[model samples]
Target: MKTFKSILAAILIVGTAGFLMSCESELESKGTASIGVTDAAVDAENISGVYLKVNEVQATAQGKTKTVVAFDSPKTFNVMDYQSGATYDLGEGQIDAGSYSELRFILDEGSYVKFKDGTTADLDVPSGTTSGYKVKGDYEINSDSRTNLVVDIDLRKAFVKTGSGEYKLRSTARIVNKDRSAVINGTVSGNTADKVVVYAYEKGTYKESETAEPADGESRFENSINSAVVANGQFTMAYMEEGEYDLIAVAYDENPEEDTYAFRSASEVDMMVAGSLLSVLKVEANANINVLINLDF
Candidate 1:
């Protein structure tokens, strides 16, 4: 009886194991059938921070050229997945130069792009191009989801201005050469009065001679050229007649003959009665004004 019972028990165990295996297989097959693949579409609603380009540029009030990038701040961009027709909102993201970022779309199975609202109408993903995704729309508020995704964006550009305005020509001169190494400074008068008298020429002639003296007590020259002399060694001639004038400084050293030397600047400025402005032209704010001087030099 024991031997028969053992063999019967082994057979029953085998049969039960086989039945469980078949039931598991059937359950898996039913599950697969229940999960039927279906085609669906998604909705694209809110979008923001769309980047656009500008063509023309303008200068600032300060005469500076400026360039700028356009973008929306505190806005949310909506990302739509094309597959399963499901749409989700992707929060605001940075849009870098030379490239763009957008939501990925899903189509049949792993296929995507067709579902994206921005995808080309014909829904063709071009070769060599990442995908054919277009910016659909932009919005400030989220009406449907009630969930607000804020988008913050920054834009930047580089621009350069060519020239700068001319500054008032308030220059000073001092004797630094040998002999008359003394400092010669002087004050400018008239429209050039911006410069204050600092020093006079050490020892130099007006042009060629050691001292600029009146031709005679009778005053031969009708108009006396206006000149400024500083205590140190610098002097300036204003309202000078349009003519070639040489500048020289006189020095009183132990030896009187070679004590004085003539000096000139590396460059010379010629004044034309017609071309030169009688008065300084001042540019203030946005308007230009002509300034005249009446004080004696």
Candidate 2:
């Protein structure tokens, strides 16, 4: 009986060792996926903050969705704080090494916008709490390595003001592998308008409807891949994937009575037309290209 007990104990020890080995092997096959959030400048005036409450960040690979960052409680982020190539680190976690096709943020309730007049309005995120916000991109995760991703929430196209003066979040965001993206730096000269916005659209993707006035609770330039607010005659559209883009420069005039900026007519610029093509840019991974929009020409 003593001999039999000894054999049983040895078998148990072997099984435990095998289990640990399997766990270690599984861990070794995983890689870390880190995520962050950022925003392009909003075109509206008097908006001091655009806040979003995120409960989880997810990555989808091969039709499977896995959480990269799961907060114990909802985390509130002022997306405007991260602009012009800046990012707010969401979190990171181990995921199976492979190619991921999409990234998304599951938002919580209580999201709102703060105006400069000391007033705050709740932002209605349609299906944000349930379906979440999705950004499509191609990302690769190698075993034992870390992949960093940035979700560009182009607020200029996402924030919509309805006829009732209520605000809504209609995000048109994109995800980029931070390590494998490019930047477009540009300078716009002879733009005397109150404000200028540069939009980057995929080559051959610009449509006439994008330039027209949008319907109530909608936004123009909603199909743009990204945008940059021309500040001090300079703009930077960062985190773009390797591809060709058509840059469109638009001019705006401030209407203080309405507390907003109106799209300036192309006739106002005379020789320099607004909403004209600035350039057709082709970029590769990690490329930094500078372009000059000389409207004075």
Candidate 3:
């Protein structure tokens, strides 16, 4: 009897050891693996379409809030028809920041890219043009909250196709620090299209502008300025030394009668500078003078 009991106890102990070994082996097999982590890539989904309108423009030679019929809904005009319309969709993965990588807009009968953050683009359509634009700048998505986007546009690019029909517009825009903003506006007539080359400079005219230039020899010329097309009629200049300086808009038309690099107008109010800021100055004359360039906020 004693031998039988010892044998039973020995069997039970063996069985328990085998069970424990099996569990240990199973754990070792599974324990060699680890958890994984990843982030899904943004895809081309949720983007239905894109629509734009233009009711006003601000140019270096002209500044007005003229109402036009082109500020309507989508489908009336197709700027991307040449690219199979669907290619220009601006939702979900189609756009990064505010600009599109594979974006195709029927501009000047061709397409241009809006890369480089804070740089404005100018697009021109038949009989119209957009200016003071950037592909990446301050923007919001779905109005959820305000965030800086990779794309932006001013009046120059917004007014490119306002006239309807098959026409071409010329425009540009740019991005700079929030503390600096400047604009240049101009018009290209049907004849003088090829003979125009424009350039801009800053001139300070105050105590704080002691280092500013006043056109030729006004003061110090800071080379950090930037320019871009904002919309059909607006061009933004940025990154200027904070002080009162002339925002000189020069146009070079090859006509012998107008061959000099001339100002867009005479009443052009030279800037009275102080600190780094952003202001939307109105262009209203052959040259506007003493026009308050409000750079607040």
Q: Which candidate is the best by TM-score?
A: 2
Model 3, span 1-297: residue lDDT tens = 999999999999999999999877654432110101111111111211112333222111122121111222222222222110012222221111121111112212222322124332333343322432112222222222222211122222222223342222223333222223223333322222222222233333213332332433111212213223112323333222233434433222234563323222211223332332323333322222222231111
Question: Which of 1 and 3 is ahead in TM-score?
Answer: 3
lDDT digits (tens) for residues 1-297 of candidate 2: 999999999999999999999999898889999998889978778899999999998889888898887999999989899998999888899888888888878899899999898899898888778867777777888889999888888888788788998888775777888999998787778778887887887888877667788888778877788888888989998898988777777778888798888886432111122355434677799988777776532
TM-score of 1: 0.13
TM-score leaderboard ranking: 2, 3, 1
Quote the lDDT for 95 in model 2: 86
TM-score of each: 0.13, 0.83, 0.22
What is candidate 1's lDDT per residue for 1-297, written digit by digit as tens?
999999999999999999999877544432100000111111111211121121211111222222211123321222221111122223222211121122111111111222223542121222202221111112221112121211111100000111341111000111111111111122222322222221111122133232333232111111212222232223432212222232221221222353322221211111222245332121122221222222332
- Report RMSD (Å) for each prediction in the order shown: 34.2, 5.2, 20.2
The models' CA-based lDDT, in order, is 0.22, 0.82, 0.27
